[model samples]
Target: MKYRKFGKLDWQASALGFGAMRLQIIDGNHGNVDEIAVIKMMRYAIDHGVNYIDSAHGYHRGNSEIVIGKALQDGYRSKVKVATKLPCHVVNSTADFDRCLEEQMERLQTKQIDFYLLHHLNRLVWPKMVKLGIFKWADKAIADGRIAHFGFSFHDHYDLFKEIVDSYDNWTVAQIQYNFMDEEFQAGTRGLQYAYEKDLAVVIMEPLRGGRLTVPPENVAKIWEEAKIQRTPQEWGLRWVWNHPEVSVVLSGMSKMEQVVENVAFAAHSQPHNLTAEDLALIARVRDTYRAMGPIDCTGCRYCMPCPNGVEIPRIFGWYNEAVIHNSPQRLRSYYSDPNMLDKSERVENCIKCEICVEKCPQNLPIPELLDKAHAFLTAKG
Candidate 1:
C-alpha cells in the first residue's frame, strides 16, 4: 500500500480508499447488504493497507453505514479512518444537523467521525447551509469531539467548487467525481488543481465513472489493444486518475473480492505523472471511441440548467448513453430505481420541448429529442 499526506494532518492515508457504496448484496437487493461478504471485503482491504473507508448516510438507503459498522468489529475499527457525510438535502433546521449526525454516529457505532462532509453541495444547498448556521454546528461538533475534520463532497460547477473551497479556512478535504471520461465534468481538473493549491486534500469518487469505464464498448476495447502495456480495463481507468499528482486518494466501490485484489495491486505501484505521451494518446483514443457512439455532446456544463420543466438533461443523457454503449438494459432500469435519482418532476419524461435549454447549450444538442430518445430507451428496457 502506498500512503499520501492527508491534508495537514499528522497521519498518512492509503492511496486506495474503500468506498462502501457498492458492497456486495444478496439477491441484487441494494438494501439487503450481505453482511458476511462486506465484512470479508473490508477486512481484506484493511489487512492489505486500505486505511480510509468512506460511507454516507444515504448510501444504499443507509444500510451501507450499518454494514460498515458491522464490518469494523473485532478490532478492525482501529485500523482505519472512517469518513461519512451529512445529508444536507434533508437539513431543515440547525437542530436537524445534530439529529442527522447523531443518527450517523449510531449507525456507524462510532463516537468521532474521522471525516464528515456536507454531502452533495451545489449552488442551491450551499446558501441554505449558511442560512441554517451549518458552520456553527460543524464547529460545535469539532469542539465536542464528534467530528475530526469538516469538508464537503462537491457536484457543482468549477466556480461553485472554488467558492465552496474558499468559504472556509479549515476545509481539510473535498471529494469529487473524477475518471478518465469525466476530466471536464463536475469539479474537473481545474477544480482539483484549485483545491490542491489551497492545500486541501482531494479525495476522488467515481474514479471509474460509476463502473462504466471498467466495462467499455468494443470500440474502446480496440484502443486498449493498441496500448503497448497489457492492463485490465479497471487498471486503465484507475491509473488515469492516479496519474494526477493533485489526487490524494482514489476511492473504488468494490463489490467483489477480485476487484479489491486488482485495485490494491494497481495502487501499490501507481505514481503521479507516470503516464507517458503514448499512454495519454491511448486514453484519448478511448474517449474518441465513446464520443463517436454518443448522440448528445453535452459536456454537463449546466448552463442550460434550471429547466422550466425540471429535467436533469445531462444526467438523463448520460444514463442513456451508458445503456446504449454497454447494451445493459438491466443496469439502465436499475438507474431509474435508484433512490437518489431526482424526483419525477425533474425526470426526463417531464420535458415540455420548451427549446429554451437548446439556446444555452454549448453543444447545441437537440435537448428535447435526446430526452425523448432516453425516455424511449429506459421505457423499453423496463
Candidate 2:
C-alpha cells in the first residue's frame, strides 16, 4: 500500500481508504448488511494496508458503523485511523450535535474519532451548522478527547466550498466528490486544489461516480479497447483522481472481496502524475464519448446557474442526460422525483421561460425546449 502526506499531519495515510457506505447486503436491502461478508472484506482491506476506514452516521442505515466496529475488534482498531461524519442534516439543535456524535462513537465502539467531518455541508447546511455553534462544539469535543481532528465533506458550489475552508483554521481535511466525469461538478478540481493550497488534506469521494463509471457504455468501452495499456473502468476512474498530487486519499466503497482485492492492487501502483499523455488523452476521449451519447451537451460548468425562476437548469439536464445515456431512466427519474434529492421548486416545471438562463448558457442550448423534453422524459411513467 502506498502512503501519502495527509495535509500537515505527521502521519501518512494509505492511498486507498475504505468507505463503509456500500457494504455488501442481503436480499438487496440497504439496511440488512451481510455482517460476516462485510467484516471479511473490511479486514481484508485493513490487512492489505488500508489504514483509513471512513463511515457515517447514516451509511447503510446506521449499520455501517456497527459492522466497522465489529471489524476493528481483535486488536484491529490500533491499525487504522477511523473517520466518521456528524450528520448535519439531522441536527436540529446544538444539543443534536452532541447527541449524534455520542451515538456514532458508541456505534463505532471508539472513544476518539480520528477524523470527524461535518457531513454533506452545502450552501444551506453550512450556515445552519454555524448558527448551531458547530465549531464551538467541535472545539469542546477535541479538547475533551472525543475528536482528534476536524473536517467537512462538501456537496455544493466552489464558492461555498472556499467559504467553509476559510471559515475554519484548524481543518485537517476536506472531502469532495471527484471523478473523471465530474470535473466541473460540486467542489471539482478547483476546490480540490484550493483546499490543498490551504494545507487541508483532500479526501476524494465518488472517484467512480457512485459506480456509474465502472460500467461503461458501448461507445466508451470501444474507446478503452483502443488503449494499448488496457485497464478496467474502475481502475481508470480511481487512477485519474489519484494522478493529482493534491489528493491525500481516494475512498472506494467496496462491497465485495473481489473489489477489495482489485482496489488494493490498483492502489499499490497509484502515483502522482503516473498516467502518460496518451493515457490522459484516452480517458478524455472516453469522457467525451460518454457525453456525446447523452442528448444534452451540458458540461456541468454551472455558467447558467441561479435561474431567476428557481429552476436548477444544469442539474435537470444532468439527470436527464444520465437517464438516457446510462439507460437507467427509471432509477434516474426516481432520483429526480425524490424530494430529499431535489425539491419540487427546482424541477423543470418551475421554469417560467424567462430567457434569463438562455443568455448565460455557453452551449447556446434552447433551454426551455430542452427542459420540456427533460421534464416529459424524467416524469414519464413506465
- lDDT: which candidate is best? 2
Q: Where in model 2 is the C-alpha error above 4 Å?
A: none
Question: Which lDDT tens digits does candidate 2 get at residues 204-248?
Answer: 998997888889877788889998988999999999999999999
The predictions' CA RMSDs to the true structure, in order, are 2.9, 1.5
Best by TM-score: 2
Residues 203-239 of candidate 1 have per-residue lDDT tens digits of 9999987887887777788789888998878898898
lDDT of 2 at 61: 93
Residue 186 C-alpha lDDT in model 1? 72
Global Cα lDDT for candidate 2: 0.90
CA-lDDT, candidates in order = 0.86, 0.90
- After TM-score superposition, the amount by which residue 214's alpha carbon in candidate 1 deviates from its true location, in angstroms, is 1.9
Which regions of candidate 1 deviate over 4 angstroms?
Answer: 301-316, 328-381
TM-score of each: 0.88, 0.96
